[model samples]
Structure formats: structure tokens, C-alpha cells
Target: MNINVERQKMADRLFLVAVEGEIDVYTAPVLKKELLPLTEISGTGVTLDLSRTVYIDSTALGVIIAALKSAARNRCRFSVVGMSPRVERLFTITGLMEILRREKIAEGDN
Candidate 1:
């Protein structure tokens, strides 16, 4: 799975997390473990970069949605970005795109 989390604090209010690897049942918990604590911190919006992720299952999606709800409960914003085509299709088909935040980043930049 080789999951790597690269965090960039965009400002006092925003933090971006670049995630790389497979986000499936085996690895989704790793993400949850890492991200759950962030929800406890006040007033920080997290942007998860999934550009390098090769796959995601329903369990992974559930974890993400759970994270979003956790963030909301703590008054923090949660977002997602850089989905691969297959991942995007999954989100589309599952109707998760409407609830999750997704963005496209330009090439050549982190």
C-alpha cells in the first residue's frame, strides 16, 4: 500500500494532505487513524489529495464520509482532491461526489 501523507499548512485555517497509495479496506484504517485526530483540533480545514491513490473500495469511501461527519461535529471543514478516473467513477456512481469535496490540481506542482 505505501501510503504517504504530506501535509502543507496553507494558512492558519487550511491544511492540505497529499495522500499516495491504495485506499482500500486494508489501508483505509491507516488513513482514519491519521485523520481522526485532526478533527479534534479546532478550526482547520483538511484537503485530502488522492491523486496517487490507485484504488478505493466502499469501506474507504465510508471512512472518508465518516471523517467528514467527524469534522463537521468538530466544526472543521473536510475536502478531497486529485481523484483518478476509476476512483472518480466510483464516487460518481455511488453519488458520493455530491457529498465529498473534490478538486483538480494543475500539473507540475504539489
Candidate 2:
């Protein structure tokens, strides 16, 4: 997997993280490392753009949940966007959809 992370400043209190890659056990740590800093930003919100991610495994999901918890502790908003159908299904089957923010968008739209 190829992973690329880009940060865009949406506003003084909001930031967006654009991620591209397959987030499996091997790559989940990359995401965690990239996002850990955001957890320290008290009250600032973060939106994760997962539009380009092709695959994710349980380990990745765990990492994401951990990130969300960290965000909550910091009083920051955490949202996920652009999950592919298969990935969305995985979240649904795993009951993560109810816990994590899942944004619906047409494929290739983002």
C-alpha cells in the first residue's frame, strides 16, 4: 500500500486530513502516527477524507476508533468521508458505522 496524507486548513478551528491508501495492519500505524498530533488540539475538529482508500482491515478500524476516542478526549470533532461500498459494508457488518462518522459520496466524486 501506498499512503499519502495531506492536511488542509479549513479554518482556524477546523482541519481536514486527506488519506489515500489501503489501511491494513501494515499501514494503520501510518494513519495513527499522522493523526496523533490532532488529538492534542483541544476543541479543534478534524475531518478525515478517506475517499481514496481502497481497503481496510480490523486493525485499521481499531486504529480509527482509537483516534476518535482521542479526539473526544480533546473535545475535537472527528468525521470520516468517502468510504467505498465494500469498505462501507465492512464497517456496517462490523458495527463500526454506528460508532464512526461515515460520509456517503458517489464513487470517484472525490
Which is the leading candidate under TM-score? 2
Q: Lowest lDDT 10-mer window, candidate 1?
A: 101-110
The lDDT of each candidate is 0.74, 0.77
| Candidate 1 residue lDDT tens string, 1-110 | 66776777889878777778888777788888777677657788887788888888898888877877788788887777787778888887897775653432222222
Candidate 2: which pairs clash?
Answer: none
- Over 4 Å off in model 1, which ranges? 101-110
TM-scores, each model vs. reference: 0.80, 0.84
Q: For residues 1-110, what per-residue lDDT tens digits would candidate 2 score against the true structure?
A: 77777878899978887788888888888888877688668988788788888888998888778877788788787778888888878877887786663432113322
Off by over 4 Å in 2: 101-110
Query: How high is the lDDT of residue 37 in model 1?
Result: 73
